[model samples]
Target: MTVLLIALGAALGAPLRYLTDRAVQARHGSPFPWGTLTVNVAGSLLLGGLLAAPVDPAVTALVGTGFCGALTTWSTLSYETLRLARTGKRRLAYANAALSVAAGLGAAFLGYALVTALTG
Candidate 1:
């Protein structure tokens, strides 16, 4: 059941991630991968909130492991950063790496804090 739930969540998450990435990237019209960054930060925020909350293990598996795992793409970020560097957009590559890490962490922390405060 847990596995099925996870699969189901992933099925939903993957499509959502793709759609969101397309929409955000289309709007930004920048070489920087704003779409990947958006999804990663969003996933981190959601996972952090789910972890901080007193949710069931099944829910955690479904949302955190499955949804977030599917929503966030470390591989895509790595590839995009490398592509930017190779294409002589070294500055943008560096910025993308640094900003993604910083923003994802910040969003996660914020989510955790919000959930903790609300639950208390």
Candidate 2:
């Protein structure tokens, strides 16, 4: 049952990630991989909320391990940053790294606070 739930969640998360990537790419083009950044931030917020909520283990596995895990692509972010550096966009690459780390952390904290307040 746990495996099944995780599989289902991963299936959903992967496609959602793809759609988000494409959407951001469509709007911003493939210069900096804004989509990956956006998705990672969003996934951080979602995972934070899930962690804050009093959810069961199975639900946690599904949403946090499977869904958010698949939805957030650190690999892609690394690749894109490397690509930027390789193409001589050193400043943009650094900015992307710094922004991703900082904003992802901030969003997660915000989500946690929101969930905590709601639950309290």
Candidate 3:
């Protein structure tokens, strides 16, 4: 049941993530990997909210363990940053890395706070 829920969530999350990434990339044009950053930040916030919510275990498994896990792509972010660095865009690469980590964490914290305030 847990595996099934995760699989279902992942099915939805992966395509959503892909579409979002493409849309952002289409608008922004990816010399900077804005898509991955956007998704990661968004996913972090979502996961935080899910965590803070008084949801059932199954829902948590679906959203946090599955959806969010699929929606965010740290590996892709790292690859893009490394690719940027390898291509001599060291400054942009570092900025991307720093901003993604910092802002992702901040967004997660903010989401958690918001959910906590609402629920509490």
In terms of lDDT, which candidate is strongest?
1
Candidate 2 regions off by >4 Å? none
Between candidates 1 and 3, which one is better according to TM-score? 1
The lDDT values for all models are 0.94, 0.92, 0.93
Please say which candidate is ahead in TM-score: 2 or 3: 3
**What digit string (tens of lDDT, one per residue) describes model 1 on residues 1-120?**
999889988998899999999999999868999999999999999988997999999999899988998999999999999999999999999999999999999999999999999997
Residue 30 in model 3: lDDT = 52
Error of 3 at 86 (Å): 0.5
TM-scores, in order shown? 0.97, 0.96, 0.97
Q: Candidate 2 lDDT, tens digit per residue, 1-120?
A: 998889989999999999999998889755887899989999999988987999999999899988998999999999999999999999999999999999999989988999999997
Model 2 lDDT, full chain set: 0.92
Identify the leading candidate in terms of TM-score: 1
Spell out the clash pairs found in candidate 2.
none
Predict model 3's lDDT versus the native: 0.93
Better of 1 and 3 by lDDT: 1
